[model samples]
Target: MVGQPSAYIIKKLIHDVETVVGKVLEDRSTEAAFWHPDRRARR
Candidate 1:
């Protein structure tokens, strides 16, 4: 019974970490897309 709760908590923590990492990667890619040299040159 105790182990079941711990397993659930661990799964939730892993999910939260994955969500944050995905958001960070998405933000970085967006910034790069807008700030790349070729894109900047067109402005």
Candidate 2:
């Protein structure tokens, strides 16, 4: 296979992408919970 990535490379790429996406989702949810005006009103 010319120019094809190995299985390890593909797995690493997928893992890296999932880590980044998970972090982004976690940050967004944390920010929304902390700063949403409607949620703040309940306090």
Q: In model 2, which range of ten residues has the least summed lDDT?
A: 32-41
Cα-lDDT of candidate 2: 0.74
- Would you list the C-alpha lDDT of every candidate in the order shown? 0.75, 0.74
Best of the candidates, lDDT: 1
> What would the TM-score be for candidate 2 when compared with the true structure?
0.56
Instruction: Please write out the lDDT profile of model 2 over residues 1-43, one tens digit for every residue.
Output: 3476697788889999989876776679766566565775677
How many pairs in model 1 have backbone atoms within 3 A of each other, for residues 3 or more apart or on separate chains, i.e. clashes?
0
Cα-based TM-score, every candidate: 0.60, 0.56
